[model samples]
Target: MGDLYSELLVKRERTAKDSLVKYGLIVLTALAVFAGLFITPLLLIAAIILGIACYFVIPKTDVEYEYLFINGDFDIDMVMAKTKRKRVKSFKLSDADLAAPLNSHRMDYYNGNQKMKVLDFSSGNPEHKRYGVITRLDGDTCKIILEPDEKLAQAMKNSAPSKVFLD
Candidate 1:
C-alpha cells in the first residue's frame, strides 16, 4: 500500500482574558508615559523602553501549529510568526497507550494527573473535534490534545485500531 499522509493546521485564537490582558498592558504603558513627562527626562526614556518591551510581550501570538501524519508516525510542529518552523513532538501511532475524545471517561485518570505533560493545539472551544492521545515517557504518562481532521483520525484508527478511539 502507498504511504498515507495528512496535515492539520491550527491557529491560536484570542480569548476575552487575552484581550483584557493586552489592553491592560497598553493602558499601563500609556499611564507611565503620561506620568514620566512631568517626573524627569530619564523617566520618559524608561517609559519608552517599557512601551517597546510591552509591544513585543503583550500582543497575542500569531503562532500556528502543524500536525503531520505520515503512515503510522505523527509529528507536531510550531510555525512561528517569523516563518520559522520548530518540531514540538514526534511519535508513532503504535506508541499511544490510549486515544479518546477529550470529554470521554477514558481520560479521567490522566486528566487530573499533574505528571501528564499536556500539549494543547485545540481551538480552545468545546465544540471542536478535540481528541486526546496518551503516551508514556520516562515512566510517566503524557496527554496531548489536538483538533485533527477526519481523514487524519481515520488514518490513525486504521493504523492502530486498538489504541486510537474516537467514541
Candidate 2:
C-alpha cells in the first residue's frame, strides 16, 4: 500500500489575466506620482485607496479540487491548505464540474477502507488507467490539484456518498 498523501498532486487554481486591473491601477498611480503634476499626494492616496479596494473586490481565484464518484456525477471542495485558517466546503457539481481540463492532475482516493490508491491521469500507459478527479471544465483551462490537508482528505472520504449520480 502506498502512502495516500504522497501519491496525489494538487495544483492551486489561479488566474493571470484577472490581476491586470489591480496591477494596472498601481502602475498608473506610480506613473502619476513620478510625473510630479499638481496634487501628487491626492493622486497617490487615490491610487492607494483603489489598490486597497481592488484587493477585496477582486474575485478569489483559488484552486479547487473536483472528485467524481463511480456514478459519474462529481463534487468540488476548495483546497484550504494555503490559507492560515482553513475552511472547507463541499458542493454538488454539475456542468461546471471540470472548469479546467488542461491543468488537470492526479490525486489519491480512499474508499473509507485502509487501502489507498493514486489517481494518475497522466500515465501514458492506458492499461493501468486509475480513477481520479478530472475538472469538468469549459472556456478557459483552470488548474486543479488535490487538497493537501489530511483532515480534508478524511472528510472527503467520509462525506462522499456512494452512487454520486442521483439520477
Candidate 3:
C-alpha cells in the first residue's frame, strides 16, 4: 500500500490584536529613535538595536498553520510570513485518545475538561472545517484544534479507526 501522506496549510487572518502588536512595535521603535536623537547620543545604540530586532520580529506577527499527516504521525507547523517554518506540535494519531470533527459530540469531554490544555492551530473561525484531537503532552491532556482537508482526515481515520470520527 502507498504511504498515507497529506498536507494542509491554513492561513490565519490578521486579527486586530496582530495589527495592534505590529503597529505598537513600529511606534515604539520610532519613539526610541526620536528620543535618542533629541536627548542623548548614548540612546542611539539602543535605538538601533531595537530597530534591528523589530525588523526580524515583525514578520512573525503574520502566520499560517500547516498540518502534515504521514503514515500515522501528525505534525502541525507554524509558517511565519511565508518564510520561516517551525514545528509547533507533533503526535501519532494512534496515540490520540479521541479524534473527531470540531462540532462532534465526541470532543465534548475534552472541551469541557477543566484540566485539559487547549491549543488552537485553526483559523479561529467556525465557518472553516476543523478537527479536534485529544492527546497527552508532558503528562497533561492537551486538545489540539487544526484544519485538515479530506486526505488528511482519511489518513487519520485509517490510522486510528475506532478513535477517529468524521460524522
In order, what lDDT does every prediction score?
A: 0.81, 0.37, 0.86
Q: Model 3: how far is 23 from its true place, Å?
A: 0.9
* Tens digits of lDDT, candidate 2, 16-123: 654675566567766666544565556666666666765654433343343433222333433433442222322232332322222223121223324332232232
Candidate 3, 1-167: lDDT as tens digits: 68888898998878898898888878887888898999988888878887887788888788999988898898899999898999999998888899898788887767778877989998888898889889998889889988888888888888889999988
What tens-digit string does per-residue lDDT give for candidate 1 at 6-84? 8988876767876777777788777778878877666677678878877775643556789999988999987766467
What is candidate 1's CA lDDT for residue 165?
A: 86
How many clashes (backbone atoms < 3 Å, residues ≥3 apart in a chain or on different chains) does model 1 have? 0
Give model 3 RMSD, 1 decimal.
Answer: 1.7
Q: What is the lDDT of candidate 3?
A: 0.86
After aligning candidate 1 to the native by TM-score, how far in Å is the CA of 10 from where it should be? 1.6
**Model 1 local distance difference test score:** 0.81
Off by over 4 Å in 3: none
Q: Order the candidate numbers by TM-score, best to worst.
A: 3, 1, 2
